[model samples]
Target: MNWFWFLLFSFTSAFVLTALLRRYALCKSLIDMPNDRSSHSIPTPRGGGVAVVVTFLVALSVLLFKQLIPVDLFLSAIGAGAFVAVIGFMDDHGHIAARWRLLGHFAAAIWALCWIGGLAPISVFGEHVNLGWLGSILAAFFLVWMLNLFNFMDGIDGIASIEVITACLGACVLYALGDADHLVWPALLLASSTAGFLLWNFPQARIFMGDAGSGFLGIILGIVTLHAAWTSFMFFWGWLILLGVFIVDASLTLFRRLIRGEKVYEAHRSHAYQVASRRYRRHWPVTVVVGGINLLWLLPIAVCVTWYGLDGVIGLSLAYLPLVLLAIKYEAGQAEAG
Candidate 1:
């Protein structure tokens, strides 16, 4: 019952805050103008993701005050996520060099690792493997990559918001199925927060999430994945499966661009989702398709892994195979067609 109110509070706070932020962004001329490398044509207000960050963090702080969550989880989510969000917010206001931004991302990853006790042992092919110190390094890089990929994937209307909502809600269900009730509230709250923001971001978007919101969500989700691994390594594979769409699309595009000697940091509309949106001549279809994929395709695989003892590596491969094919079909990393 208490958790229900928390979820409601999170949703209402994010909804009202996003509305206020939209007005503020317009007044301050913080609008994202369309360009050759952009997805949207008409200029729209951005930085509305600040509402999600604020609402989620406030709810998290309250949970901490009530001792409803562990201190390490609180620090990892709040401390590291705040660092990512602050840097992202600053970058949204003015240009920040990619190098500095990457450095800050690494720093935040380290903070999260320090509090969360580094990467927990992970299951691989029915055997638990502890990577020891090497795990820490890999986890740090993983966190950085997750945050960056999220930033890259937040190109179209409501896609990023929808991804977060579905992924988090899926995770909450996994936790409940595994009887890890303590883990459900945080994930539920995150979904609720993003759901409120989606109202303003879906289809013809009235506002954008900007780097602040997307990057914060990336690191926070990564942290949640790690935290869940501490409880059950299979849950890590579940998360990896749940986030398969973004992970597969962003990673494939990035690697392909790197191989072609393209400067990956510069913005471009070559992602699978972006190309699909252009092909469909609307953003809503692509967004809706992503949501459909999450609910219908990925969620069941995640449940199988997290609750049914499916081998983590095999499960991930099963989950990613079709997505990889889809990325290729969409020309995820290819140059935009004329």
Candidate 2:
């Protein structure tokens, strides 16, 4: 079957699987209990993301088997995705220590770095940076950070799904613009699977993506963006622009928490989206606004970076400056104070 039909299959599989996972979670009494730190008030079955993971991996593996994707990239993405999904699944069912989760994240990041042959020397506005060994180390850290920040931003009902769709579609567009069709298939598949999850997850919550789901999305996005950058280092920032919504909120919130001398490891309802959700007293509108910003503010920047071969530093700043203010205005790190 062509990848296009597989897109529909992935979406249908995710939707059906999400419903099944929700039932299994409810029957098994595996639920997320709402608390001071939580964004939801009612307990909902988590780990619906397992559906997303299974469908995406299965679809991607089929492509690999068909020799449709590069062998090294296929291995790295699936291997890293599987590793992080396991840790996240374990954390969802039984609490895994943060340190252990971090270790797993780093291990997965390193595996991908090895496969990608490390970060290629990058072009930053015509200035060259040769990272060498340091490039791989930095790339590993970048992957882990993306993995964890994605988890951090998965606070509201539909925000994570929105982020996944927006970023995936944006990546697809950028890749196509570059004539880098090799990378488009995985991104498109991810968007479709997440879209399936979104049907149940959005507008109202029926089930949550748990860590398994969100972590899988995170690791895969990291790998996809890495592949983008590997193809053309200029594309590193293009991927960043495409994902600016989650990237800005999560990165700034973490920075604020760190500066405030707060324990960053503890889950808190302090992300910008969380603050907005609390303000509106609903999740969907905030999710919608985020999607709006992604399409309105970020996608164009990504297009510019892809087509013009220009440094996205300006686009990155144009995109993030407002979000930084929103984070500050929302008092993103003041969950304890609030």
Candidate 3:
């Protein structure tokens, strides 16, 4: 299987399909209209995520038919992704109960855990920690956590796309260094497709990912990280660093919502990205800032994965320090200013 061919096909197919589907979604009135609680003020076409779904399914299907990747992992990940996509589409079209959505998330997570093998124990700084029977449970929880984080962070235009691209680049770099096969193609495919989608999703957005795009991308990235972790220690550390931005922002936002009188489970436009977008008065800048940090800073730290082995863990820790401080300061400022 030539990866070059696969990457080209993934990019070309996804871009073409996104353009065509964007028109279709608009024609069908599958759009997200601005609301009092929305960061976006204009009604934009939604469900372009069907492009992401179709692209990943097609490329992965070809690979599976040719036996280029593991059938269980490939099929199971798609199933989980599709499950979330369905629920997201439902939410985009109409109101969906939180409990029902949470139930779907749990079902997808369990499927991923059962099919993708349990999480590999972490052996850091010469200390071994075997999760034993608990590994499967953690693995399932990780899947659900990542899915929710990505979904939560999808408010602003182009933010989620850029984050996913940054993560895929980090994954690709590690795979290149180690010549890792299990994760390389999937990461590249995801990055290319997301890049194509970002064209219309940036400032003055033309379309929204809705829950379908964000949730499915989340599932794909989470599963890819797990697959990478199983392959090598370098892959594991790199995935953590790649995802730190989203993790910190989403976790802090949720915590603050809890602190406030707001219902944590309800929808709100209080994410750091949403706040920054309103303050900065431009969507593209926030998107660019995130992409820059991930590409310029996080990607470099991910490269350290190859050398010093797990010794480069400190770099990962340092990379997240600024993001943590930003989250804290941002939340505080929001409270005072509001």
Candidate 4:
């Protein structure tokens, strides 16, 4: 019942499940082929995220059953995460209509919030702001966006896995520092499980996570942020700061696409990290660079935000400003195939 044991089991489970899924995908022809919009150069077995999700959920349920996590938190996260993963799994093997995906995302978001007891007054820069009727609507939008952005950033090898590890570790750090030990286990489990996947995903990816894994991560993380905010309003800022890399890249790229009259829903490799990967002609460097930024740059800034409970908005902007500039420098505004 100790966390370390659970962590080890989760990690090993994910690693073994990934291997099995890879072979299954190969046999099933579940492969992702390189295309004009893709970042990879060869067909690779995909749907590895299913292993990640299944292992994660199984571990999470054990923790919940043991009363390590609250009933509501467990229920909300499990319910929504499983549903989103199913949608993603379906999408990974074949095509799913955009509208249906959107609807599923909205439903999952609402399902989580409903179980988690809905959104409270949100904060910006240590100031309390109320959303009233618009709260649910905006929260749904944010949840959907978070899930989709993870999908967007999952283009290159190991990036999504790296980001999840960083954020989950950040959550553990913040909780430990704040003396909220009860909240640390979920983050620890998530980080370690993803690390198991990262071993096979990085350097040279043997398998891709597909839509199922990426979308599952997004929903879980979105719920995590909301739950953290509920725990301490300042915690949301810390969580966001931890996720700054993907948030900035995805948001900036989407904004640029909207400005340039591009279809926002279409596939493209124009994200900031994607641009950097193209520039370097490899995925590792960009992945390392972003991982470094999360650790060296954002982590310290996030600690300040979570610790100070003041100037979170300012700290967040300060943390993101450089990433935005870097995206611009790399011409993330331009469409790939330009």
Against the hidden reference, what TM-scores do the models get? 0.98, 0.97, 0.93, 0.97
Which lDDT tens digits does candidate 1 get at residues 230-325? 999888888999999999999999999999999999999889999999899899999999999999999999999888887878889998999999
All models, RMSD in angstroms: 0.9, 1.3, 2.0, 1.2
Give the Cα lDDT of each candidate: 0.92, 0.85, 0.79, 0.87
Instruction: Give the winner by lDDT: 3 or 4.
Output: 4
Candidate with better lDDT, 2 vs 4:
4
Clashes per candidate (backbone, < 3 Å) = 0, 3, 0, 0
Compared with the true structure, what per-residue lDDT tens digits does model 3 show for residues 56-171? 87888887887777877786778898898899888878889999998999899888777777687765765667786697788787888888888888888889998998888877
Q: Candidate 3: how large is its RMSD?
A: 2.0
Off by over 4 Å in 4: none
Query: Residue 100 deviation, candidate 1, in Å?
Result: 0.3
lDDT of 4 at 18: 92
Worst 10 residues of 1 by lDDT: 121-130
Best candidate (score: TM-score)? 1
Candidate 2 ranges beyond 4 A from true positions:
none
What is the Å distance of residue 131 in model 4 from its true position?
Answer: 2.4
lDDT of 4 by residue, 109-211 (tens): 9999887766667777546887765887777788899999999999999999999998889888888887778888778878888888888799899999999
Candidate 1 stretches greater than 4 Å from native: none
